[model samples]
Target: MYDFLLSDEARVLRSEVRDFVKTIPRQLLLDMDADRVQFPKEFLAEAGKRNLMGCRYPREWGGRGLDWVSTVMVMEEIGTLGYIMACTFGVGAELVCDAIIRHGTDAQKEKYVKPLLKGEIFAAECLTEPRGGSDFFGTTTTAEDKGDHYVINGQKRFIVGGEGADYFLVYAKTDPHAKAHKSLTCFIVDRSEGVIVDYIYGLMGCRGGGAARIVFKDAKVPKENIVGSLHGGYAVFNTMMIPERLGTAAMTIGAARPALEVATGYTTRRKAFGREIAKYQGVSFQVAEAAMLLDACRSMAYTTSRAVDAGVPENEIRRLVSESKKFITESCQKVVHNSMQVMGGIGYTNVFPVERIFRDVRLASIWTGTNEVMSLIIASEWYRKYMDDRASGITRDCENDAVEAFAEGEKIYE
Candidate 1:
C-alpha cells in the first residue's frame, strides 16, 4: 500500500529517525517548549554523530548522499518532536547547506558546508528585514563593495538560529539603483565579524533554537564570500525557497500526527454516556476528517519532493511547492485544532500534548512565506503558464473540452 509513496530504504530511514527521536527525554522536550533549553546544540550534535543531520547532502559533505524523498522522511520523523527541533535541523541541512552546494565557491563549501552537515556549526538565512516582510527585494540592508571586502550594514529580524549560528547566508542590496531583482547579492557572513544578536523573541510557540533579531553593522565580509555571481541574489533566493517551503510542509505532517494520535487514544478510551467517545459521530467524524487531510497533505508533500529530485523546471516547481506548503500547513492547523476539539477542554491544557502541538503548528502557515503569499505565487504562476501556452499556440485539450461543451452564446465571459 505504501510502495508508491515510500521505498524500503526510505521506510528504514524513517524508523532510524524515529528511534533517535524516541531517545530524547520527555523532560528535554518540555524544557525546550518552556524556553529553558535554548539552542539544543547537544541534541543536534547527537544527531550529527548518528549521521542524521543531512541525509540528502553529498557523502563528501558529511551527509548520507540520499535523495530529497529521504530527507522528507527524516523531517517528518523529527517533526514529531515539535516545530523547534524540525526547523533547527532544516536550517543547517536544508537551507544553509543547500545554498552552499548550489552556489558556494569551492573554498566556501570547504569552510562551511562540511562543518554544517556534521552539526559542528549552525547557520541562519538572514533575508527578512525590519522594514519589509516578504518584500524580499525591498531589503534595505546594504553591502557596499570595496576592492577586496564588502561592508555590510543592516538588521534582519526573526532569524531562526540567529543567536547560535556560526555563520549566516545574508542577502543585501549591492546595487540600489538597479532593478529590485538585479540589485541584490548574497554573502556568507561569520557571526564573529561584528554581527549582533539584537533580540531573541519571546515566542508564543515554536520556541527553543534561538530565533532572534540580528544586526550587521560595518561588518567586513571578504569578496570571496559571495554566493553565485555579484548582484545575482534573486536567483539564489528563488532556488532556496523550493526546499525551504517544501521542508516545512513535510515537517508539519509529523507535527500534526502526534496530535491526531493523542486525540484518537483519548476519544477511544474516555467514556461518555457509558460508551467510548469515539463511538459518537460528532467526535469520530473529526478524527476521520483529520486522517484524510493528513494523508492528502503527506501525499502532496512527497510528490513535490520527488519532482524536486527529478530537477523539474523552477517555475513549475514553484507552483506545486507553493500549493503544497499552503495547503499542508493550513490543513495541519485544522487537524490539530480538530484533535483538540475531539478531546474537549482537556486538549486545551498542558495535561495533554495536543495543546502544545496546536500552538506549534500555528507558525507553519505564517513562516517560509505566508500562506497568503503562497496563494499569490500559485495564482501568478498558473496565469503565467496559461498565457505562455496560449502565446505559443499550445492549447490544453482538457481546458478546450470544457469550452466545447458550452454553447458560444451561453459562454457569458467569452
Candidate 2:
C-alpha cells in the first residue's frame, strides 16, 4: 500500500528525508537524550537553524512552509532517532504553532509565533488545571478585564513545556457569567508577567520536554493579547484538533516503527537454547502480526495526511482525522506491547527503547482527546449524519418493507 500510495514526487521527498535523517550521528541524539529533563533551548535553536522546528508553518512566518506530509516525514525521522527529540519539538511545532496560526492576532503572531518559529523560545498550552485533566473547559483559572489589560489568576497543572517555555497560551474564564463553553477565552500570556511555574515534573517517559504545574498570581496580559474573539476559546481548540490529531498520529507511527524494528533485530540476533529467538514460531508470529498492524495504522495516518493536504471539507476532515488518530494510537500501543512481549526481559530493561515507546505511546491515547473521546466524536458524527439523511428521505428501511413479505415467504417454505 505504501508503494501504491506514494507518488513519484512523494517518494523522492521521502527518500531525501530518510537519507538526511540517517546522517544525524547517534552521539548527538544521545546527548539530547541525556538532557531530556527540561527543554534544551540551545538544542531547539539548533533544530530551528536546521529549519526543523518550523517545518509546517507558513512561509510568511519564517517556516519552511512544507505541507503535512513533509511534516509527517520529519516527525517520523526524528522519532526514528528517538522519542524524546520528536515529542519535545512536537509540542512546539504541532500544538503551539497550531494554536497561533488559528487564533492569534497579527500582533500576537508577530510577537510569539515568529519567535517560536525561530525556536528562540519554547511554548506551552496551559489548559489543564489541578482539578481537570481531560475536562479542560472545567478550568478554574480566571482572567478579568482591567481597563488596558487582563489580570489572570489561577493554577494550571500538567502543562507540557511549561517549565521552560517563554510563552504560555492559557485558557481562562473571560466571562464567568457566560454559560458552559462560552465562558472560556484564550490568551497569549507571556511568561514574564509575574507568572510563576512551579511543581515541574519528570516523567516515566517523554522526559525530553518538561511538563510543569504553573500558578499565575494576578498576571497581566494586554487587552490586545486575547486570541480569537471574546469567550471563544472553544473555537481555538477545535481549530487545532484536526492538525493535532494528524501530527499525533505521525508521532505514534514514528515511535512504533522503531520499537518494532528494535524487537525484530534483537529477536534475530539473540538466541535461546541454540537457535535465534526469531526462529521460534511464537516470536515470528508476534512480529508478523505487529508489523502488519503497524503498517495498516501507518497507512491510515498517511491517508489522513493526504486528506488534509487536499483540503477536504471540514467535517469530513474531522472524521478522517479522528479515525486515523484513534486507530494509529490504539494500534501503536498494541504494537509496542507486542514488541515488548517478544523481547521479554530485554524489552522491560532501560537498555532497550521499547519500554520508553510503550510509555510514550500510551499517553497518545490519553492526550489529543483520549481514544474514548475519539470514539464519541466519530459515533456522534455518524449518528448526526444518519439522522440528517433519514430526515431528508435519502435512505429508506428496506428491512421494514420486507418484514411482512419475509414472514409470508417463511410460511410458504414451512
Candidate 3:
C-alpha cells in the first residue's frame, strides 16, 4: 500500500533493515517479554554493526542521511519485533538524535550523536516527571546556574532506557520567574554523579526496556552540555514531536501487523460448525475490517511523514502528527482486538503471538502523548489555521453556500 510513497533508495534501505530484523534472536524477544531482561544491549549493537540504525541521520554520524519517509520505513520493519525493541531503537535513533541534531552544538553532537548512532552507548529522553506526563510544562525538575555548571535536582518517572541508557536528554526548569514555555532548558545529563535510578516499575507491556524512575539530586551538568540555548527547551520539544509521535504511530502498525496475519491464517484452518470459520461473515468481516484499518493507518503515517519532509508550517505539522499518532494507534488497538476475536479463545493464550501483540499495542494510545491530547491539538490547530486563512481570504467562506444564506434574521446571535 505504501510502495508509491517510497523512493527506490528507501526500498533498498528497507531491505537492509529487514535483513537486520531477521538476525534478531527469538530468545531475546521471549526473555524481554517475560521480564528476564532489563535491556537488550546486543539488539542495538548488532543493528549498529550492520549500519542499519538511524537512517535519517548524516553518514558522518553513522546514519544513511535518509529522509523521514525512510525512517518510518525503518520503524515499521523493526516494529515487528514488538514494542520494546522498536521503542528502544526509536529512543536513541529518533528521539535523542532529533534533539541533538536540531539544537546541540557541533562538539556536543560529535561527543553524543556519533557514539549513539554507533550503538556504542545507549540514550534516553527523561521528560515525564512525578508531577505528570502530559503536562510537561508542570515539571518540577530544576537546574540551578552555578558559574561553570549547574546542579540539577528532581525526579523523572516512566523513562524508557532509564536503567540502561548511558546518558539522557533531560528537560528542567531553568528560570522560575519566566513563563512556562520559556522557563525550561534541555540538557544532556550523563548517568554519572548525582544521577540515580531509584526505582524500576513493572510495566503491563513493552517490558525489559529499562522503564524506571531517575532521581537527580545535585547532578552537575556542565554549561556546555545544555542543548540549544538557555530557556529554549520548549522549541527543542516542539520539534522533537515529529519523531516521538510519528515514530510511535508508524511502529504500532508494524507491531500489530502480525496479529492480523496470524488471525487471517488461522481462519482458513480453524473449523466452526463443521466448516471453515473464514466462510462466516462474523469471521471474514473481522479480518476485512482489520486489513482496512491497517491500510488507512498506513496512509495517515505516510502522508504525515511527507508533510514534515516538505517543510510544512510548524503548527500544521503539529496538527498532522497528532492526528497520525492518535488515529494510527487507535486503529492498531482495533486491529488487534478484531484479530483476537476472530481467532476465538485460543487467541487469548500464549500459544499464539496475538496476545503479546495485543498487550503491546494497548499502550500506544496512552504513550507519546495520549490520544486525548492529540484531539486537543487537532481541534486547536484546525480552528486557528482555519480562522486565520478565512480572515485573509485564503479560504473560501462556504458559510453562505446554503439556500437560506440571506436569512440573516434566522441567524440569531446571543
Candidate 4:
C-alpha cells in the first residue's frame, strides 16, 4: 500500500532489503530465541553484503543514501522476521552509525562506517549504567584523560549485542566538575584490552541478540577515537536519538502488523460454536481494533520520519519523535495483545508467532527510553513550544474569550 510513496530508488532498495530478509534461516530465529545463538553475525554480514545495512547514509560511506521513509519501509520488512532481528539490524545500521554520520570526521567514517555497513564488523552504543538509565546524564562511567589515551572505567547494563560487538560507542564523564550536559564525552572504543562482556541469561524476551553487561576496567582508548569534540557528548547524544527512537518505533510497527495478520488467519480457519471464530463479533472486533491501531501507528511513524527528513526544527522534531515512539510502541503492544486475544488459547502458545511477538513487544515501552520518558519529552517540548507561541503572540489567546473573562480571581493558581 505504501509502495506508491516510495521513489524508484527506494522501491528498488526495499526489494533488496526484502530479498535479504527472505534468505534468513528460520532456524536462526529459533536458535536465537532458545539462546543457542548468542548473536547472529552472519545476518548482518549478509545484509551488509547486499548493501542494505545503512541505506540512509551516503553512497561514499557504503549506504545507498536512501531517505528516512525508505529506511522505515526497509525496517518494516526486516521487522516481520522478528523484533530481535530488526533490532540487530537497527543497532549498527541506524543507531550506532547515526553518531558517526552526524558528528564523526571522515576518517572515522572511513574506518568504522564502511566496514560496519559492509558487515566486516559490528558496533554497539553503551549508555545505560548499573546505577540508572532514565537519568541518562547520571552515568557513573568515567574516562580519565591520560594524554596519549583515555582510560575508561565503568559498567553498562543490559547491552544488546554486547558479546558480539567488535567495538562500542561509549559515553563517559570526561569533565567531572562540568555541568551535566557538558561533563561527558563520546568515544569509539575497540574491543581490546580491559573490555569484558558478561552475556546475560534467562531473559524474559529479546534473547540471543547477545544481551550482556559490558565492563570497562581501565579500557585503553586512543584520543583519536573520541567521537565528537571534548565534552561534547550531549550534542552527539541528541543527534543519535533521532534514529534510535524513530527506528525502534518503525521496527515495532513492522513487528506488530504481521502478528495481527497471523491471528486474523487463525480466526478465519478456527472453528467456534458452529462456524469460523472470525464470524463471532468477539473475535472479529479484536482484529478490527488491532488493525486500526497498526494503521494509526504506521501513519504516525511515516509522518514523523518525513518530519525528520524534512529537517523540522530540533525541538519540534524531538516532540514528534518522542510522541511517535511513545504512541506507536504502546499501540503495538495493544495490537499484539488483541491479536493474541482474538486467537484464544493457541495464540498464547509457541505454535503461533504472536506469543513470541507478545514477549518481545513488552520491551517496546521499556527500552529506547521508556514510554514514560517519551511522555516527559513530549509534554516538555509541547509546553515549551506553546509558551513560545504565547510569548510571541503567534497564537490567539483563548483564555480571554472564556465566559468568565472578567472573573480573574476564579482562575486561581497555587
**Model 2 per-residue lDDT tens digits across residues 350-396:** 79878777877777777767888788878887887788888898787
CA error at residue 91 for candidate 1, angstroms: 0.9
| lDDT value for model 4 | 0.90
lDDT of 3 by residue, 204-268 (tens): 78888888899999999999999999999999998998899999999998999889999999999
**How close is every model to the real structure, measured as TM-score?**
0.95, 0.89, 0.98, 0.97
Judged by whole-model lDDT over C-alpha atoms, candidate 3 comes out at: 0.91
The model with the greatest lDDT is 3
Q: Candidate 3 at 223: error in angstroms?
A: 0.8
RMSD (CA, angstroms), candidate 2: 3.8
Order of models, best TM-score first: 3, 4, 1, 2
lDDT of each: 0.88, 0.78, 0.91, 0.90
Ranked candidates, highest lDDT first:
3, 4, 1, 2
The window of 10 residues in a row where model 2 has the poorest summed lDDT is 28-37
Which pairs clash inside model 2?
none
Model 4 over residues 1-414: C-alpha lDDT tens digits?
777668999988878877887799989989999999999999989888888878889999999888999888888889988888888889887988889988999999999999999999999889889888888899899999999999999999788888899999999999989999999999999998899998889988888888889999999999999988999999999988888899999999988888999998999899977899999998899889999888888889889989989999999999999999999999999999999998878889999888999998788788889999999999899899998999999889988997788885887779
Model 1 over residues 1-414: C-alpha lDDT tens digits? Answer: 344666776777778888999998898889878888777787887888788877887788788778888888888889999887899888877998888888888788889988877778888889778886688888999999888999999999988878788899999999999999899999999987679885465788888867889888899999999999899998899899988999999999999999999999999999999999999999999999999999999889889999999999989999999999999999989999999999999999999989889888999998889999999999999999988988888776465577467567765775
